[model samples]
Target: MAGIFIFSEDSALAKQLLTPALELKASLAQPITAITLSESDAEELAKLGADKVVVLTGGTWAEGFAEAIYSQISKAEGSILLVGGTLRGKHVAAYVAAKLNAGMTTDAKALKIANGKLLATRVLYAGLAVCEEEVALPAVATIRARTFLAPAPAPAAGVVETQSAEADSRITISEVIPTGDKGVDITAATKLVAVGRGFRRKEDLKLAEDLAGVLKAELACTRGIAEDEHWLPIERYIGISGQTVKPELYVAAGLSGQVQHMVGCRESKVIVAINTDERAPIFEAADYGIVGDMYEVLPLLTAALRK
Candidate 1:
């Protein structure tokens, strides 16, 4: 059985790491193992059907962390190694693959093992397309976020293991910054209320905020809101270069619905658009569209909701 390592964090998205590992195991017909930070993490990995869990020492270097993973991989008797596309996962994959001289793939959306070899698929050309890749050498790969649809089937044997770093190294975490949602990370939020250029002035943001409060949804903004007026942080922008969200509900206020913006939120389960322009592109994709001034409509919606 091949060993698959998932770089995980203690966050709500922890299960996201398991999806690719499970898929890799199913495709390869092998046992998938997980490497985590602590014993508590090991327990959670077990619930995801990992065959083995390895916890590293506190002072492990990034290279040392790579070495720890390689050591376990050497003993796991697995030919292929798979990692999630997270930043840590990418760094470890590159470091370990270089140390081991194995081929590597990044941002893989689909992965498989065919004829005892590794095959990975990724999207390219601004996510408008996809391509299949074959890593001829024994290698490590990093997968993209939210690509794996389902977790691997469960009820497999879980073996907990404690392993030490191959090299004693110094690691210091000097700073920790939250990228999304200093107030609210819209991408991570289950529900979102997004504002667009149709908002006109910064004062108009209150209308969107009020609606968001009424719906108990996080607030998001388009590039115009950030670049044109500086009403929101640039990090809060949602587009090809900014954050992507697939919330349970996405409400767009005063947005003209540009194609560039629409692509980012296409996966939203339910999209409700409020724009005075009936010809706005957003209406085509929105499940519900209201053709009216956001200022006029928002108050009515909020009042009804509050009632």
Candidate 2:
């Protein structure tokens, strides 16, 4: 049987990866394991249907970590690997696959094990099309974010093992400059309030911010809102080729809800749209929509929510 490995740097990602991996594993009739950086995290991962949790102590590019996992693959003789499509996860998956000389499928929306081999589906042409891929050389696959929800009740107890790997000394990260406000990590937030081009001036963002504060949501922006007018940082953009999110709720203000933008947030459970144009495409995906001037509606909504 193939061993499906889910890689996580933090508990939240573990929360995201484990459930979907477990669901996919059950669907494929494969065994699932989680790999993390800490035992505490491993313990948490086990609750999400992981049959085992392996903890590795090493930073990025630590060849030792890869070597340790390679050793585990040798022992487990597992044929299938699963990883998140995040920058770090994708990078590590590629490196590991190369080191193992395994076939790799990236940004796989779905994957299945058939006839003891891996079959994966990936998007093409900016989601205009999907292509099916078959991996013959013992595959490594990165799962797309927001594709599945976390499983309920967790899985049975799982074993935790601490492992050590050799560190790669070739490159070192000297500093990390995070984007957005010091407190904002929109992609990780449970709720997001995004603004778009229909908003007239940069000063109007205060209204959106107030709504976000009332809703206890993070602030995001469309590509035009962020890049064209500089109303928000480029990092805040949510659309095709940008950060994809599956927030519990997403409230978009003055956004047209273009296909590029909707692709990123389609998995959001509840979408609320506010735009003056009743014909805007955003209303198609919105669970609730309000047609009126954002300047008037935002303050009212924020005040109502605060009450």
Candidate 3:
């Protein structure tokens, strides 16, 4: 049966897409199928309103992951395929889209259905404008995390179809490194408290750290703080030269709000800038601005927010 398909080994991301997938299913009278590695998460997908779950395994992510997915969907009729837009995930989506001759939209912030096709809204020109386009049937799109809230679990469980995929002997995983061993992945953080080069010394990071603890936000930093000053891990860096984050709330302290830094955080739902310089560019882009020294303001904020 023709159905909506979501490709992600990440259960949380799969669950997030369920809300929209179920919405589309209801309107089109189609089913929702989640393709992932077979496990308890497959059963959980059913609770999230998926009608069927395909569990695939037997290869390192790059080795057989893409091949297994393509082998299964190559026979399907008109259907929709959605995936997370992580760097590697982009490779997989691009490969499949090219093979199927399907249109695709990458880094889409929003997705909906209209005229029986997928309509996606994406940021363009460094978040200066929005681009909306309709993708044809048998199309694919890579969705950004935090773009959609995870759907609530449904009472009825869907069926699980286990499929064995042999590893692609031609492809091999060269090596693996643990990213978390470095530091927090700022990209996945919903709330972020980022510091900049305003701190005279790296030791002053404690001020921002305290604020982060109280706010329960991931501690992030500008390129100078992480790269030059070495106050935080490289993974915690956010900028055009670092990582991009779209947190719901971004509390930036001491940052001048340069274009390079703003490009990374322009998608944040709310930006709160705390800086002593009244003319700082950060104030122009922030939803809320405070013209005060972060050293004093952060301490006051921490004391007030402390439990």
lDDT of each: 0.73, 0.78, 0.81
Q: On residues 1-307, what C-alpha lDDT tens digit does candidate 1 reach at each position?
A: 4566665443323456677667667766667677776667677677767777777765534434776777777776556676665666677778778767788887776677776667788655655566887886466777656665435446765888876665534565667766543665567788888899887778889988898898999888888887788898877777755677899999998887776677678789999999999999889889999999988999998899898
> Model 3, range 1-307, lDDT digits (tens) per residue?
3778877766677788787677777767877778887577898888778888988866547425776777667765537888866666678788888877889988777777889778888766655567897898777888766668888878888988888787668766678876653555678889999999888888898999899898889898898988888778888888765778989999999999887788789889999999999999999999998999999999999899895
What stretches of model 1 exceed 4 Å from their correct place? Answer: 10-16, 60-64, 70-78, 97-105, 114-121, 131-139, 144-156, 166-173, 177-190, 223-230, 233-243, 256-263, 274-284, 288-307
Candidate 3: pairs in clash:
none
For model 1 the TM-score comes to: 0.72
Q: Estimate each model's TM-score.
A: 0.72, 0.71, 0.79
RMSD of 2: 4.5
Best-fitting candidate, scored by lDDT:
3
Point to the candidate with the largest TM-score. 3
* List of clashing residue pairs for candidate 1: 2-78, 181-184, 181-185
lDDT of 2 by residue, 77-158 (tens): 6667777677777777887788678999888877776666678888666655679988974688877666556666463777
Ranking by TM-score: 3, 1, 2
